[model samples]
Target chain A: MRAIAFKEWLKLRSWLGFMLAAHLVFAAWLYLSIRHQFRFEHAEMIYYQANHIGRIFYDDLRYIPLLTGALIGAAQFLPELLRGRLRLSLHLPMGLAPLVLAHLGIGLEALLVFLALDLAALAITIGSFFPAAFIGSALLTAAPWILAGIAAYFGVALTLLEPRRRYQAANLALSAGVVWLCHRSGQYQAYDLVLGGVAGLVLLLAPASLQAAHRFRNGEP
Target chain B: MTSRLLSWLCLAFLTVVLAAILLPAIYAMAFAPRVAPTHLFYSAVKQDFVYREHRGNHDFTYATASGEHFDRKAFEMSLPFIYYKNMELWGLLPIEIDGQSFDMQAIRDARQVFELKAREVADRHPSVPVHALLDSDPGKAGLSFPEDVFRMKPDRMEFLDVDENRVDPALTDRFTEALAAERFAFPARLVAGKQTILKPFDEGVFLVDAEGAVFHVKRVGDDPVIVRTPIPTDLGIRSIKVQENRQRIYLGLVLTVDNRLFLLQSDGYGLVELPSSGYDADRMDYKLLLNPVHPTAVFGDGGTVTAVALNEDLLPIAAYSRAVPGTTGMIHARISKLLFPVTLSLGTGNSGYLGWTVSGPAPLAFLGNLLAVGVVLLFGRRRRIAPQQMIPQLALAAIAGLYGVLAIALLPGPGPATGATGG
Candidate 1:
């Protein structure tokens, strides 16, 4: 298990580093924009705009996490599939399930770490300008977006590893629908009621790649 | 075996979710209802309710409760106050009714509009937990934003200075003591205020305390004037809306848990209930139009609209209702129920939260299931799937209907019959 995880990391470390640096740059951009707003405008009026007018000051960060998830999934899996490395990996002494589990586990852990950095940036920036209450609301609002990042990671892997063309297209459609639902909300805390169901659905997608890997090993199209 | 089961469950869940998202959109695209805008008003001259059904731009149909029809010119003359500009242009001003005369100025001053839409109800969107209290008495200069905003806590109220981004301990203690002096309970449940300077004046904030008592709190030149109203502690108040107009006749509007609407008047903070029968605050849109002589309350859903007019004494004078043609009885609507058993939506008109609602499948959906199963059987025969593999495919189609059929078509078994995986 350690060797397999190390192999995955060796392939992903440089891409992961690039993603971390890019995420920090985005966070810094969000922080600077907020500071600039406060420097010019009356703080009270800006507060009223956010509270009453429903202006999302940090909307620039909304799609960054999604892009990070998709790129990292591609970096980790696209080369392996193109070089037929996944076929050799499946024939290792370890079983197919263990091999697939290692790849998903490592990729998911990395994606979560990146998402956490984005959330922390939001917390520190919002807390600097507003009260602690605003921090809580900001986190709740960003929860679904972060969840979408995770779903995108799994979706890329599932789409690439599937054996047939039609099933891949179907998986792509289903995954896009789920991601769109996660991004549908425009206001703060809009998904609070059904967030648990959304998390459950994302969890169900984790094991889906294993079925595709099983078919690939059987030489099925 | 566990991998296979998990995969099947994943496919089933994805299939249902996709159907819920796609089917509703298709159904709406194929068959969505069109509704015409209708406005109701009370004619003091006729002493009855009259309404205008707007068919399209520059096209209107006007009728009264007594079956009297009117053209565009007659309709404008009937509701004189509504079209007072036209009345003035046509030299029909200074109309007398009920032993009183009203000109354009008098009509403008007495007109008050209170509108509540279905989407504006409780929990529809998130609000900032803290509120800025505009100075009610700005003295000469005009109303300006306060330097600090206040938040409600369980035991007391806290004030935070926006510039400093910290609490103002002195102002917080002062306001908390004022509320405590008036016996205002801690941890306010609902707080309503218009945090804008665009209004004529600031009436401050109206809040419902934990004990269900309503209180008015405002800032007057660096001091807080808190008044605890005589509103019943058991009114089960749902929400309060504060709009500061020029008249100062009322404080704001109050909605109760039992769907009762009331006016929080300024005359000693009296609660005057409006006649709101056949109104559902959660689903229907509400509009209250107040003129010099009467107030008309209008409630409309998609299918039906009802209007009730009241005298100055707040007694119901007459009521009129109209039925709007909707798509519920249309052929496409009934067909959609048979095609898609359930739908999933991210947000609803009544709430900002995302939720899943599964409508019970109609009995006709069984026929859809049967047809889908037959199609799957034929497809499997063409693919030459073994009897063992075909059973689950048929069962999925029979149970999940079109969703399952689509899933089966998208994902078929391995190329011939591979016994098992070498891995």
Candidate 2:
């Protein structure tokens, strides 16, 4: 467990520099946008203006994690399955669940590290204009981060279980359907819950997990 | 297992927070009470004697008389008929003094004296209608009283008075008989020193002293004219016929007479007349006014008093009225309250564009949901990359967080001048 967690941290560190740069650029753009849109004449007005800026920042921030999860899931898991890497992994002196959990843990850790950096960047940029209540506002602004994290976790688990070209196609189609349903019902808040539940259930019931021990015994590779 | 548990925990927390934010609107919908409705009325009195003195700079006396209730109900019911049918009676009554018509000033003075004597007489009797006679000469037809009286003189000159004491009775009787046959009689009543007759006759008399001061006598029916000095001490007199329905209670020297229209009824406090000036009929609100301009400024509880000033072409140039206080304030308060629920709901949806502008802060909950979707997509995208190649995924996550902060900081505050656009 410790080794796996360490490996995840190493993976996260590789992306730290680029993530920091992107956050800085986005923060500057957001600041300029806010300044152009609002003119604050009093302290109260300034507070209100800050709140608006924060909400916009958070709304766009939520999409990054989910998009990242989908891309990473397709790249890392699908090819391994097509090439029969699962048999090689099963021969290792580790339980299949632990090995899969290790991969998930590393992905989640990298995502969390990136999220933390994003949060720090937001706090610093927003604080310059709203120094008095920066922390409170940032925490309030972080609510989206939690929901995004949950959806990413489910995505990683689903990709590992259904690591085939057809399954990936099916997952993409299903994602579109879920988005459409959410938009039609105007139920954006419940999007993560629905998506997370569906993905997690599919992963838990994956045929790959049940066939892992049998495939290893037969030496199918 | 730990990762799955963490995910479940996060979801549960998000649901609870959303429910908490929606509570205020739910409670308001379920249990908020409605406000009660109210009604109001308004009217005014114009050109009455007290109102005239009040308008002018004169200090006239006032008196009140009480009799058999004066059948106010009958008067009020017949008011419309009287106003439309006999609108001419709305003008000033002509009073002849010493065979000369009295002007506005003299008539005003006579009316004041009549009010005083009436009040004095009513103080004693309190039941009978007091009739105080004015002293005037029957032969002085050429003498003019005052300008206003002259302006109101009858077109026909047949109604004239002649002195019987200065002419032969036989010749005067024939002239008097002819005038009587023509329904013309002496317009002035007789005054023997301080005594005066209140009845109409052919040869009524008046006595004027060296100072031009006059006194009148009282008469009952065709009975011999009573020569009582200073007139009868007490005769019940209530109010002068000014405008229809409005009356001025004699409040000492009437230096200022206000047109008081509606009476406020406080269950335990009896009836308190509301001043026509300060009361706002449209809004049913009241404020204090030092001086009011019109006599007919009175209106009932729910009535409105509008001031209409027209230009030379009779086009309405300016109009003024007061807004009802409580109602106006209440409406503004309600609007302010509505802003809160709408603002909160927007915040919950991560929909920063829901406010007045597309760039404004959206619901925090909405932002959260968006962030959740973004993370899921980001993680999925990076799944095929080497663990060492996760730099771009991390970068995207950072970008999403920063965007969230920017949206919230630009939200507009509540107020009219802020110009926060509606959702």
Model 1, B1-423: lDDT tens digits are: 577556756866676777867877777876765446677677888888787775433556788878899887888898887899999999998999899999999999999888777666654556768998888888866678988999998988899999889999999999999999999888899888888888888899987899998888989877999999999999998877786778889877788888899888988989888878888887788888888887788898866788888888777888888875445556776887677665566565566566676765778788888898888777766666555666666777788788777766665432232431111
> Which 10 residues in a row give candidate 2 chain B its minimum summed lDDT?
B144-153
Backbone atom clashes (below 3 Å) for every candidate: 0, 119
Output the number of the DockQ-best candidate.
1
Top candidate, metric TM-score: 1
CA error at residue B335 for candidate 1, angstroms:
3.3
True contacts kept of 2: 0.00
Docking class of 2: incorrect
lDDT of 2 by residue, B31-51 (tens): 443322221111112111111
Candidate 2: misplaced stretches above 4 Å?
A: A1-20, A27-46, A49-59, A71-86, A131-135, A164-221, B1-423
Q: Against the true two-chain complex, what DockQ does each candidate achieve?
A: 0.60, 0.01
Q: What lDDT does candidate 2 reach at residue B361?
A: 30
lDDT of 1 by residue, A1-221 (tens): 88878998899999999999998998899899999999999998899888877788888878877788888889988999889889989999987777897899999999999999999999999999999888888888888898888888888888888767777887777777777878887787778778898877877777877777877676675
